[model samples]
Target: MKWLEGFQKLSSVLFILTFQGANCQLAVFPIGPALVNALAGSNVTLAVSFRGAPDPVLTWFKGNLPVGTWTLNSSSPPDIADGSRDVLRIENNGSLTFKGVPKHFSGNYTVELTKSGLGQALVTFTLKIFESIQNVTLSTQPDFAQEGAERFTLQYTMLQGVVEQEIWYFNGGKLKNSTRYLIKGRSLVILEPTRTDKGSYSVLLMNPFSSVTTHRNVTVLYGPDEPIVEALPAQPFYKVGDSLVFSCQAEGFPKPTAEWVFMGQILSDFHQGVLNLTNVQTSQGGVYTCSVLNGLTEEKREKNVTLNVYGM
Candidate 1:
């Protein structure tokens, strides 16, 4: 009942984005952005400074929700003490602290101040747990590439922390939730990784409390196994109006598609597995590529060859 008196004193503070009482003005200071991101199972601490002095009440929130305990009530010169048992909320050191920020902790928060009237201010921080592991360790297999072996493998071990599962992810660009990912282990090793697999590769560790991620570079092995591409002019020279034949070959678990890339970056419709160019001219000279991609497996292989047009 007496706590209601504390609300009357906080009226001096300005309220922004009211959520409660009329006179209970709440103002969330240093509210820079509405969205944020972080890795899972990682220890993350957020720094927030509030304004409005004289009998002010403060609360801590995660994403759009609140975690642990928010202290807006201790009348004793701003000191942190226990508020509840089952629900963990801390009010100390003039700020709020949450141990090991997790996925479920992502949400919006409000610091409501209630005097005789109820007024609330909002200072929300969104936590998006990343895939970086703080304790566990990760390593890739078959360190060296044999030029064209087209094999890239990565393995991981958790030195500390609890790991529910580990996943290997490969991407040519930015990694997304929809990006291709595989459950990698001793039994499940990475497939043939060609030059294309040299992009960003990362590992994710999933757990109930937190999630972590690690990144590594994938190297292509040399084995002359690259899709061998040969264009016309197999001889010393060639003439115009001549038939240009381009063939691409590669070896891997699943076969890859080989295509011809023209000057316009267009595909010459390959019907019945044959790429034929009719009446080839000097302008048709450019980089021809054989690209094999299976959207399902997220595996792709490509080889390039230059066509030289000469006047015979």
Candidate 2:
């Protein structure tokens, strides 16, 4: 009688195991951290899956409140527990989807699965919805700064959620925190900005979910450093039919204009900084002056070149 009783107990345990094994196994795909990131006004889906029982009731809860539910084998649409039926839906594969998600939809979500004669299972996820970065603007306090004299600042602003990172760029290259550059939360300060500091400045703001970028041009006023003159042919003395080409150049913002002066007269036609003399004669020889002027800086500089022409 005792052996028969033991056999009966074992038989009962086996029956329970067999029945549980036949139940549906609920699971979430790519199962690492159950976190979902989505941008506001975007369509997003939170996927889930199950095996075994073909007909199972799935109930989705946002936080503690029920949001939606559906029967896997039912042809009808998912029943919405809340008034968000138009924005939320349950797919045939038991996944929850959101159409044009709003910021208010960010919260914890849980899905429970159950069958008529099977065990129940539930999974949870943390959904984070963020507003897309937009309306970004970049500007500078002073439209233009003076080289070696003024501190320049570039600032940026955007309308969006919290930004996780702010990056600065100068001339398409990444900028780092240094003595010359001061990077604030939303601004960049250039200490004693130089001519080299002038270019396109950009700011990139980003978070774990979204990113945006904006840029602005910066101007720095500096030179007419010093006028420079270069004469093409080898110089010692030029005779009869010598073609002489002189190039005048200077470094300045707004591009300094050059005026070539032979002896004491201004060469009007050589305003482009190039002086071309064809068939140079003995009389066309003296100290030539190249005057460079920066209209913006109002600074002028002069360089002289001596050309000695001998009689043929």
Candidate 3:
């Protein structure tokens, strides 16, 4: 089996809704444009034209990433547009649309055709984005203002029916126009958070019609405590009949692990690092320490306790 790519100007073939057969042709209008910029919560429309193709399958690309294709169920919502704005009709039409949009969704797009039985054609459009005045945005991503050292990616999205002229914002400020980012639908992405970005931000719907806003307060948090282990028996004294219960505890992102310790050694003798002595005897007494460890982060902790042995 061999592959072939025979190009006659382009490779897309178009089929008229009617039976045009091999005479169908594909044409791209607005062959070139600087960009197709839009505000968040806005729909972007592409102007195009097609002709002369037996079967045309639409493929869409943004920047270099494939947004999706317009074949079979080729439906993609624009920026932040409601589902109503995403379908492209007229097998010969050039208008490809992005429904509602988000800040990071701005870029260049190309609507291409893969005509197996005919030819191919590609229409490229550049897209730019701005804060939308249409809807109040909610930052659904976790509030990670805490853990100043850990990097976190936060996400925000806009709802429908916002005042389209109002100023929308994030991270306590408007997104800088020059930042290189990706806007996928009505979603705003914060690549990584830093110390300077710890604060509250809101989406402001400002216009002569009506004004409203949605805000989110972000705060960083830290620390629970080191894990410490101790024997339930009296310190420096344990009787033969006493119940010997060992307790372990720690703190971290996942509430650090607590493990039983005996004679300065961790005891994973139990299925899950748990070790318990049903009854203590004068023969069992020593310095025990709980070892807390998270191998992934290379974080470990240890705290010790001591007990003495006595006859029952």
Candidate 4:
């Protein structure tokens, strides 16, 4: 009886202590996390196990506000004024169930179990309700950026959900906030985007109930570096019937287009950036221009090579 008396004075605590007397016993044990997470519009159960008086009365509360109660062997729960009467259900084993949890119902929940002869036992739980993430899409402003540009932005949007965390990845590696990178609520910005930044980028959005990941391939347009024109023969003058080979090389993101101009006319046959002239003649000696153009960045560059032919 001393243990029963001491139990009666037990203050409100989370699964504080369990007691068992000769004929009467009371034990409340949690089966899951004390902090429960549920999705809005989804059926959720806050479960617990109890060993107490056969005709125990169980009452539920939200913080200091009384929620509802369930009498032993009762089919329906006793309602107070919480409006949970429509969705909340008390199970036979003293567990609470929400037919479809509401986002606004997230808060601390407590359960009180008592009987006439025995003391009261209390268990507390923290409930969190979140909306499911759906229709997630990742995109970049302008879809492409030029190298050395001030900045580029990547953003993601979701149809519904409360994001607890935002994570970004670049080229399969985790991205950290740095001088070159900025993370906002739903966007990521990269300063001075370079060719190295042209790769796969992904973002992860998470919540209590669900998480989603979206990916996009970002493009960073760079150049057509200064073109270089090379000739096979190093001599300034060429002899008739001699073989001459000219090649133009350049570097760029989209592979710059090379055009060979001879005598102010585009040489259609030498569009591949190489010109082959065999059996060189005195009339064929002039200046050759190799023009390199980058369609993406609109960058143009050119190199010139001169040939002088003499008859021996």
CA lDDT of every candidate: 0.52, 0.84, 0.56, 0.84
Candidate 3: segments with Cα more than 4 A from true spot = 1-132, 135-212, 215-221, 228-230, 251-253, 263-265, 268-275, 281-283, 293-299, 310-312
Q: RMSD for all candidates, in order, please.
A: 17.4, 9.6, 19.4, 8.5
Worst 10 residues of 4 by lDDT: 11-20
lDDT of 4 by residue, 35-115 (tens): 988888889888988886675788888899888777868766565456777788877787888888888989999989888
**TM-score for each candidate, following the candidate numbering:** 0.31, 0.49, 0.35, 0.64
| Root-mean-square deviation of Cα positions for candidate 4 versus the true structure, in angstroms | 8.5
Residue 138 of model 1: what lDDT? 50
lDDT of 1 by residue, 14-125 (tens): 3432533343343455434545555554555454554444345554544434344335456554332343232233444334444555555555544443332335455555
Candidate 3 matches the true fold with a TM-score of: 0.35
Candidate 1, run of 10 with poorest lDDT: 79-88
Q: Which stretches of candidate 2 lie over 4 Å from their true place?
A: 1-133, 144-149, 159-165, 171-174, 198-200, 206-210, 217-225, 239-243, 251-253, 278-284, 310-312
Return the top candidate by TM-score.
Answer: 4
- Of 3 and 4, which scores higher on TM-score? 4
